[model samples]
Target: MNTEQQVETLQSALLARARALADETLARAKHEAERIGAEADTRLRVREESEQASAKQRAERVYRQKVQAAEIKMRAELDQLRWAHVQQVLDALQERLTTLVEDDAVYLPLLKALIARAAQAIEDGDLVAQVNARDYTRLQAHWSTLAAEWVPGKRIVLSPEGEDCSGGALVRNRDNTIRVDNRFEGRLERLADELQRIIVERLFATATPLAMRG
Candidate 1:
């Protein structure tokens, strides 16, 4: 081949090689860009999924907290209601006892029984009997015979100072160290828990049948 023709052929060959390299480089660049875009899309999807999962967990936690708060509030309200109901029953019982104290015929026998019970509880015959102001005078009139029947051996003393009690008697040992409280308030106080249990049971039983209550 001639020198110019050879040179021209060399130039053409060089130009074709450059074009091929440029096309390959562009293809590589495009593939790299596509790979980068796919990776970015995957990362964005993963971040969104993670955020959604975290939000769901947070919402569940908040829901649980709300439920617990509501349960505690309801329990507190129920407790208050139960306490109010129990108090109302006790108040009614106190009123009834006060009415009983006003009736001498009904209360006198009860008083005698209370004194006897107190005497037995103290196990001491020589004890001072303390009563309410109204009962103190009545007890003074019957002291002689009452003492003879209840406590024969030991001397019984009726306190001139009235007790701040709702009927019944408080019998104390000779030195006033030991005492047996047979007063209405004292007895009721001692039995308050049992009375409250019974009252609650009855109230619930009436409101709901035993099977349904469970």
Candidate 2:
């Protein structure tokens, strides 16, 4: 073979090697780009899922807060209604006592019982009894019987000063140091809490929902 032919062959071989290297480099670059794209897609999916979870938790918290607020408002309203009803029942009781005082047959026995109860509280002492104007005259007429039956062996003075009250009397010791109130209005007031509780129980047991009765 000649020198020219050998040179041409060598040039062809070098060109073929260069083309193979270029193809290999392009393939490596494409593989690197695909790997980077796949990693970015995976990161995007993870971020989206995390954001959705956080939003759901926030929604649930807000819902719970709203429910709690509504329950509080409802309970306050229910308490207000119960208080109004209790007042009405107490007013009715007061009206009934006032009516009973108008009947002499009922009022007389009740008044005597009141004086006896007041006198029993102060044993063996000089006591002054004060009653309403109408009751004072009647009681003065029956002083002998009342003195013997209720307060024996004690100086009992009926006050002409007379109180503005129901059938019962207010009896005080000699020096005005101790006093007993046996008035119908006072007795009722002292038991107001117990009366209100009873009223609530009867009303709720028959009229209200089962859940509210407790």
Candidate 3:
């Protein structure tokens, strides 16, 4: 009950209270630190997974784009090559055609064949052959023999007309009603496309691809 005894009791109680509060504060701080560490670890793992997925997606997109671009470029190059090859082939074919037409033997046979074809078309009567002044004399020398072979069952009289012609002869009756064209160059010029086509087919039979000439 004395003042000294009361003072000692109060001091001991205050010391015990301080020790208990310090222990509680330390435990609470440790618990908070553990929670914070777990949260940080979780956030790090999530970020790493997301970044990996994004990187994989980007890589796949780049690969697909590259592959597609390469395919398109390849097709373009192939088309260019194909067109170039076709143009070269056509140029060579034209040169070959010009050479064949300029040859003597080839031109002669072609002229003879055209003449015979026109002569065979003559009607079943007497025929008067009309030609330009240039070719009139030439036909006169060979008229009899040519008619004999050209028109087997008909008679032909060779006559030179005043009309201007490039080459070849025109056969007409006395009345000049029905006529046949047998000109030297005229007949060939008319049939130029067909003749060229045939010649090309024969000469370039072993070529890479057949020509489609118009």
Alpha-carbon TM-score of each model against the true structure: 0.81, 0.70, 0.39
lDDT of 3 by residue, 133-171 (tens): 654665578778867776667777777564365454676
Among the numbered candidates, top lDDT falls to: 1
Tell me the deviation in Å of residue 104 in model 2: 1.7
Between prediction 1 and prediction 3, which has the larger TM-score? 1
lDDT of 1 by residue, 8-85 (tens): 999999999999999999999999999999999999999999999999889888887877777777777766877789
lDDT for 31 in candidate 2 is 89
- Which pairs of residues collide in model 3? 168-183, 168-184, 169-183
Ranking by TM-score: 1, 2, 3
Predict model 3's lDDT versus the native: 0.65
Residues 1-214 of candidate 2: C-alpha lDDT, one tens digit per residue: 6999899898888888888888888888888888888888888877777777778777777776776676676677777778788888888877887888888888777877887778888874789888888878877887777767777777788889878776678888878888888877777778888998998887665655323211
Position 107, candidate 3: lDDT: 45
**Model 2: clashing residue pairs?**
none
lDDT of each: 0.84, 0.79, 0.65
Candidate 2 local Cα displacement, residue 4, angstroms: 13
Per-prediction tally of clashes: 0, 0, 3
